[model samples]
Target: MSFKYIDVIKELINKIENSQLDVMEKVAQLCAETIIRGNILYFFGTGHSHMISEEPFYRAGGFVPVYPILETSLMLHDGAYKSTLMERVNGLSKILLEQSGATKDDIIFIISNSGRNNVTVEMAIEAKEKGLKVIAITSLIHSKSVKSRHPSGKKLYEIADYVIDNCGVVGDAAVQYENFEQKTGPTSTIAGVLIVNSVISRAVEIILDKGWKPPIFMSSNTDEGDEFNKKILQKYKSRIKLL
Candidate 1:
C-alpha cells in the first residue's frame, strides 16, 4: 500500500481518539432522557450510509426505540422507480418526518458521507424546526473540499446541532492499495462502526447513572430469545411503535 493511505488512516484514528467526549455524553443523555420521556429516536441516511442507520436496530444489546426514516413503502422507496412524475418530484424529507411522527422531544441522527444531499439536508432542517436535536455523522474533510449540490449551498454541518466527523476522503478511499493508480475504500466503514459502538457504550453509562437498566435487545437467533424479547419490549413498551 501507499504511504498516503497509511498517513490518512493514522490521522483519522487520532481525530477520533482526541474527540471531545462531551458530544457523545450529550447524545447519550438526550437519548436516554427522550426515551424515558416517551419520545422516539429517529435515524436517517441516504444510499450507503443507510447501513449505518441499520447498525443499531435488531441487534444484540441494541435500542428498540429507534425509527429508521427510510421509505420502505413500495410506492416511495425509490423515486427513480416511481411510475408517476409527481411522486418522483415530491420532497422525500417531508414524507419521512411525517410518517415517523417526529416531534420536539424526538432525537434524530443523520448519516451522510458527503453531507450535501438535498433530502438529508431538508430532513435536518425539518427536524430542527420541529425542535429536534439532530446529530450528524459525515466526513468533514470531504464536505469542506467538495462543492455541495444543495441549492441553498448549505451542507450537513451547517444544519446539525452536533457533528461527528467520519474520517474518510471524498471518495471514502485511503489509497490505491488494490490498484496502484487509484485510491480504494477508506475508513468510512470503520467510522460507522466506531460511531455506533460509542453511542451504545455511552448510552449504557447514562442509563446506569440514571439508576435504570439499559434497555438493550438480544438477537432473536439467541437461545434466550423469549426472555430477551420480553425484556426489550417491557423496556420500550410505550416509547416505540413499530409498523
Candidate 2:
C-alpha cells in the first residue's frame, strides 16, 4: 500500500527548505536576541493549532525560556466544539495575553493555519500593540483565500512582524481520492511543527556562535538528565507559568 501522507510531508519539507530558509534564519536571529536579552519566547494558537504551541515547551533539547499561552477555552481538551466557537470570539485575545504574563521584551509565535480567525488575528494585533514582536506561522494560500474574521479586517499575516508560510494547500489536506469529494490527511500540524523546530534549532546555533550557552532541556530518560533539567526548570519556573 502507498503512504500518501508520508509523500506529502516529504514534499512539504523540500518546499520549506527551498523557500523558507531566509525567513527562518531571520526569525532565528530574533529568537537568539530574545534569549540573550533575558526575555521569554511565547507560542499561542487555538484548537488544533495549540498543539504547535506546546511542542517546544519543556521538551528535550528545547529552550528553557520558552512558554506556551495555553488558554483553556481555546484548547480542545475540555471541549473541541467549544474551542472552535471560542476562537471566533472577539476581545478574548486581550485577556489571554494579559493572563500569560508576557512582557514587551518577549517575542511570540502565533500559529493559525487559516489566519482568518478573530482570536488569532486579534492576538497578533494585541501582541504588537504591547510592543512585542510577532511571528506568524500560517498557510499563506489558505489565509489569502479567506476573509478576515476579526473586526479590524486583518489576518494574522497582515499583523505579524514576520510571516512564515506553511506552504500548505487551501484546506490544509493534501491527499485526494478518486471516489471522495473531500481531501483527507491534514498537513498543517506536520508542516507547522517542522517550521517551528527548525527556527528554534537554528537559534540555538546562533546563540552558540555568539559565545552564549543557551539553556536547553534534556530527555529525562537519559542518565543525569533529570538532575540537569530540574536546575533549568527551577531557573524559569517563576517566569514560565506552565513550567
**Which candidate has the highest TM-score of all?**
2
TM-score of every model versus the real structure: 0.83, 0.98
Could you give candidate 2's per-residue lDDT for residues 42-120 as a string of tens digits? 9999999999999999899899999999889988888989999999999999998999889899999999999999999
20-76 per-residue lDDT for model 1 (tens digits): 456767777778887667667788876667778877866677777777776543123
Which runs of model 2 end up more than 4 angstroms from their true locations? Answer: none
Among these predictions, the greatest lDDT belongs to: 2
Clashes of 2: 0
**TM-score, cand. 1 vs. native:** 0.83
